[model samples]
Target chain A: MNEILKFFVNQDRMLGRNERNLMYTLKYNLKDSRAIADNKLFAKRIFKKNKLPIAKTLGVIRKKEDIESFDWSKLPESFVLKPNKGYAGGGIIVVYGEDKLHSKEGNRVWVKQNGVKIYQSDLEKHIIDILDNKYSLGGTKDKAFFEERLKLLKEFKLLTYKGIPDVRVIVFNKIPVMAMMRLPTVASSGKANITIGAIGVGIDIGSGVTTGGVYFNKPIEIHPDTKSKIVGFRVPYWDQILEISTKAQIASGLGLAGVDIALCRDHGPTILEINARPGLGIQIANNDSLKERLERVRKLKFKSIKHSIKLAKDLFGGEIEEEIEEITGKTVIGRYVNMNVEVRKKNLTVLAKVDTGADSTSIDSSLAREFGLLNSFDEFMEYYKTQKHESKNIESYHLESILDFANYRGIARVNNGNGTSIRPRFEVTIKIGNVKKKTIVNVIGREELKFQCIIGERDLNDFLVDVEKKI
Target chain B: MESFIQTAFVSNPTLFYYLLLIPVISSIIAMGRNVVGVKSYGFQTPMLIVFAFLNGSGGIEGSLFLIFVYLISFFLKTYTKSFNLHYLPRIAVIVSLISVIFLIYFMFFFKLVNISSISPIEMVIYISISEIFITSMFKSTGNKVAFLMFFNTLILSILAYIVVLFIPQWFLLRYPEIDILFIFITIAFSRWKHLRFNEMIRFRSVINDMDKE
Candidate 1:
């Protein structure tokens, strides 16, 4: 702890809470925040005045009378309804074309991107709730506005699941400091909110390609549902995204601002919103401290927006990949390698296949029996079968004790050519050359397979695959 | 000059109470502003200063009456939904209601307290406290307003009471010019941009993240 404190003390570039408040009080005027923070309409007007590309506003409903007289049919097939003073992603409804499905009362239904059908009355009630400030930051009365729903760019559609993704860029002194692309997930319910389980991928400011990703604060490489690689996703129109974010920051007159930008299929990059006090989840996504970046650009003067963007890309970009590589200390292995496998106090040298497609490592059950691991498995299975017949509510500790007696870690579901079945998992230390790692491997009946063990990608993080290397 | 100071302090020691009131109020406002980031409109400081003076003169009983007014006004403002009243009219109602409550309390408990007569200054202080309460209620929710108003008044009142009771009257009388030091204190507080003590805990992650880098 003292070392950590010393490290922070030595980091002169890090911005603390005191410095943030001082910056706001000294550099930002309170009146300027009113133009962007209090009401979204005023912010849109400012964006329009500055000639920044923003989502076209369809209408603003300030009162119940406005909602009653408003023509709903005139709205586009797909649009977004949001509260003007809403914070985070609260009180936002995204409609994705009209559903042909019959409503309960046979009225017209609007289909959400998630496939939920909404009646016209439901939308009206939502609009009324917005007008009543149900989602406002402080419960002040707010206006409900309809905005053109930005079509997700083709590049992001594959990465996101049933939601539109947006990029959040933190700009200080008109220079982009750090940025994270928020991808909506099934868990986040089609809203790009990290707190609610959306994936936040760090973008390389220099290259605009995703360098890393985090889901629920844990580093992850693939989208949970799509199982597609999240890193190295080259964002389309990266320069335009930065330019619009910086322009929004300057237009809002906030010395430090979070600019949210989304790519529209037809309109290109559009400004979504400007946040005066953005959350700190971007730090977790980027695996970097914002304070250091903010302080680095504190005194630098930008001759133009293009110059500032270039300066930002030069200063804070391209280091995330190197930092990750240094931290993991990973080495490359091949598709087939000779390794010494140890299980239940016995070590056997065997040839193993490296398969990145598999989620977990698997070991042949015959090989396990040869090493005396099946004896404990039989003993545990006897106890488990007896307990299963006696009662359905088995204590977790008792189950853990059974696994401990059997020398197995836990159970996992394995899929092979035959079918999928549950198998007992055991802890195995595989030493490939001089590198040794203890990983959990499932014991399966793999008599027809050539290799006795197959190492999966989860255990392969410390080793990169050399596809052409022959063992 | 020394003789004049001695005579002035000896003749009217209560004047020192009013002089000390400025720092007490300014310190409270500055603490609230720096620590909590709450903004006060034009008259909050003057009203707090007046309340501090009243508390200094009338002691514990005056502090109790101020608290009673604050609580009653806060409750009335929160519970009375029928009067979705505008700003000025709502303040007028609250002020009148506080005055009525004070009148009833005075009529009943005048004998228990030693300070029986109400001065014009005291009347202004009561009205100002009521106005501040109403204005704060307008700006924030009931619980926050109640907590801030209650604590601000209680702290300033206790401080004023201590200064009145413990500080030697002769010290103030001899060095009346020492009161000017409050001006410098206020300026110093206004210019202080250091992190509040609580902010250190809030930003401890940034501090710890330094080690990771």
Candidate 2:
């Protein structure tokens, strides 16, 4: 623990106590719950404003007068009664229709599929409890809001039990950092929170990329409740979602936050609530960390929303392959040597891969001879032919490489390590998926790895890669 | 270091009380992140008191004793609640009174006592203090709400502490696992979904299928 703290401190990349504490407090205090609570009132208002979409509010009830004098006929057969400040789906009564409702101690209450009805008196008791504010953020009194319940999206039916499906978009500095679609599980306290027991699907931060759905905190392809595979659902208006989340950061006076969005049949894109203190479950959903990604955002300077979104993508988007490349100081993702290894220096197309399986990225020993550091290896090799180093430093390389990498068109660089003891060949550039770049790499014997001028896994995944299947 | 562990696990007979905290902490983190409750102080403290009950009443036997405890405490709290007393002070008085009575009755009638050689007076004082905190919470809030959360903490902690008991490989690995469990629970709990027993109260209104009440 001391070492870990010292490492982060030595890097000087983390926020100080005041900012870190504020960021965390702001997550719980400034947003998430408050914004969700505000939704009780603003939900109807936002729907009136035509800001994307939301469930229409039938009414917001406070004391007895609100329920007694209100028009009962105006209510849809199926609607949701929720605590304006409720957390974790508390004090909520959902009616499938009139058949599912009953008069309990003089007031009508909603029922679930199992024929459980929340009586009006029970609602009153719950409301009184809320009024007592025992279950509020600061134990403050709250009201109850009634709204039309949303139908679960077809694509999400398997992921959800009976509640509406919600997608969480984590925003930092006005950009969407990580995104996951949370489906309600019976385990999640009857709501779609991943912590209690919900299924989370990692979406591509780019194009809302969705991958690796998990349940019960383990990698799982099928929903534990519904027994269906969770995959391949595209969120409409990906950019707009990020835009709304960014706009919410400004609206909520919070910088680091999450925006809960619901897709309605009529409303299209609805902002369910904004969460200030979003959980780290997002890391499991995305299989990454908010701590590290937030660190990147904290270091950046942006003038407007545009710069922020760009930084979000660069920092936390589907750039895992790229991050690994930068960290290992080796071009690992894209560059692979072939019968025709074409090296080009006129224009650098740098895409790297990450390979934890290998000890060191090996290039042609001739490349090391060019950098004049081959003697260092020889000196160490004289004592022992093999040496091991935990060198995870990034060093850039510019290589003049001619071409012929399996008929792919690109010049590349061999990204080198920071230490001077290791010599780097010229830069090798490999284009994986859509991204391309040049990087410095070390040159060594490939008799073991069996590929000439091959871009190590460290560099191959820097961008994205799809192996071209050909005849 | 020795004193802290001694206090947590050894030397202190009610170290089990602190042991109960592990599950409370886990459950609260679970509730806070996944359950999304406005209630913070969480269910752990009350749960600790509940564990003490099972411990004092001799495990399963104490569960039977809880019925009497509930009836008596409920009658008293009902009086205190209706009197419109300010929350904190009313709880303070009720807790003190309940602690005095329970300590006397439990020690004399149930013949239940915490066995520690340190000091009989200290043991008595400890139980008194513990009772004061639990009783005040019950008096301030209704016993039902306190117990609901208390039950939640107890259930979760029982499972968690039992699992933790099998771990630690003799204490060297114990401390780190606590922190790890904190982080792991934080991440895992982010995805929870389930219904609260409170929902059962809410659902009672809709149970009759429009049978003309």
Candidate 3:
């Protein structure tokens, strides 16, 4: 299939119009890729303008003098030091949790990629390589920057090594057409780009939802390090995230573009940078091709950017998740609790739970007196024979209520022959993980059952129980 | 990397096999570069040299196989000359037919073919060089072109052979990052276009002619 796909892709006729567009001269519109190429500071400028959140830049260290005069003390404890014009993820040092490399006799220190470290010595030798502009645009001399390291939200800590979470939005004509949430992996050495082992989670365009993520070119449902389920997540500020990304398409002047957005605590979303020839991995992550989606979007010229955004939402929004599943032909295993049951007369140890949120624990009326606890004779018979009929038994079984607190309030007067006639609350010792907790579980006999415990908010706070985890 | 550093000196047979493929892919990408200006096939000439070195005949038996390939390609190229096809097609028909001819020739005339008989695919690879040569026919103009191209390729092949033979693991480590053409790659290719060596060498006679005039 791959060989066949490659063959068709290279075929002139088989290629689409968007692909044909790729062969032509890049456009001279707003957010032009060349402009982005000419200036790195434009990304910073855009972030600052919209009140979008971004990391605080300590200094743009250019030349030896800038490096010398810049207060090294102004550098935040555990800040991100990086090359300003340096290529992607290159010339960056992240010292997490008060990191200062030790020299002989431990003098208090400041370090750059140069000045120390032989690994960086190769980088300096490679600086000649970078200055020769082997890695830069036209081999021009470069500048570097120092900025505060970002605090990753709780969702990303275990999944990323040293890298912060960043979202790549493919904005076409001032509308976000596609997106991928890239998380750093150990192999990426804490960088979010997936080429080096970071995971790319496909986001559902219709809903600001995440589907199963991928790593090492294979689709995965969980983070390898954190063991967190990798799908159905609400990316923060859904509409605003899309709005800012769309706004960037107007800013960058590149008609076909990729906008990288990073989150800040104070600022909502900041533009990381703009990419002209954004990677096809976004297509892979989003589970759709840019050619097809962009084709739909590229149609219908709009008078204003607002109409274009509305059109984008109409055309590409809902179909994103479905298209992703179609392209990959795989099911996203969501973090859901499920079970299979054999419905019959069986000794099924129906695991039960209790919630103090309920006023009383109800049992099958047949066990009322069998466990040596007396109940009014008339009330027990009436409750078991006809459950829907509600009657007050203040003199008899006033303490116990037969009301089913499962969904909408209802009555369940269930009984089996083996159940105790006296419905006495049994002290159930349910073991969950390494922790043991005690609960009052009513031994109920019924035709069938779903969940044994309601586990309302009241009793849940004590054991810190996860209903998904069971013995 | 430690293991790669250790394997670097060994020159294993598998390394040669994998190394042989680099040229094949690079060849395809080189075609892409010339046609599309994608710059995907950076360092193409070196890659082709590497390919040829790894695939070339090594010893006396290997030489005899080479002779068989030459004999087969020569006959097919001649036999297919009357066909209406272009140079490449002519070469292709000849190359395909050469495989059968070599197999037949070996069966009738010699026991020198390896494993008591040359494998069909091996014969195909040997004959395929005729197609490469046919492409080269359009590569340049004037007398001594073929000879110049041939010798240049030969030297490159030898250098590629030495590199592949001595530092097989070095190429393996570095090879995956090949075919990456970024803004950086564009920057590099642009530089390569302005190269002075190829310009001076290719137009030496023209310069001499102009000087004489």
- The numbered model that scores best in DockQ is 1
lDDT of 2 at B83: 67
Residue A211 in model 2: lDDT: 61
Give the distance in Å from residue A19's predicted Cα in candidate 3 to where it truly belongs. 3.1
RMSD of 1: 10.0
lDDT of 1 by residue, A1-471 (tens): 977668445443444344565665346636667457557889899999999998999998989899778877677768888889886677788989887556433345788876778787778877776765556776687889999999978877778887778999999889999999999888887778886788999887886767678897777878887777677667788899999999998989888888989888899989888887766668767766677688788889879998999998899877544544453354545689887988666888988999988988888777777776554555556665566555423554566544443566656766667786667777777888778888888877536778888888787766645455468
Can you rank all candidates by TM-score, best first?
Answer: 1, 3, 2
Docking class of 2: incorrect
Docking category for candidate 3? incorrect
From the highest lDDT down, the ranking of the candidates is: 1, 2, 3
- Per lDDT, the best of the predicted structures is 1
Query: Which structure among the candidates has the greatest TM-score?
Result: 1
Candidate with the larger lDDT of 1 and 3: 1
Q: Estimate each model's TM-score.
A: 0.56, 0.49, 0.50
What CAPRI grade goes to candidate 1?
incorrect
Candidate 3 lDDT over A41-112, as tens digits, reads: 656676567665556777775554553455645545556655556545654566543325643222234343
What would the TM-score be for candidate 1 when compared with the true structure?
0.56
Candidate 2, residue B45: the lDDT equals: 41
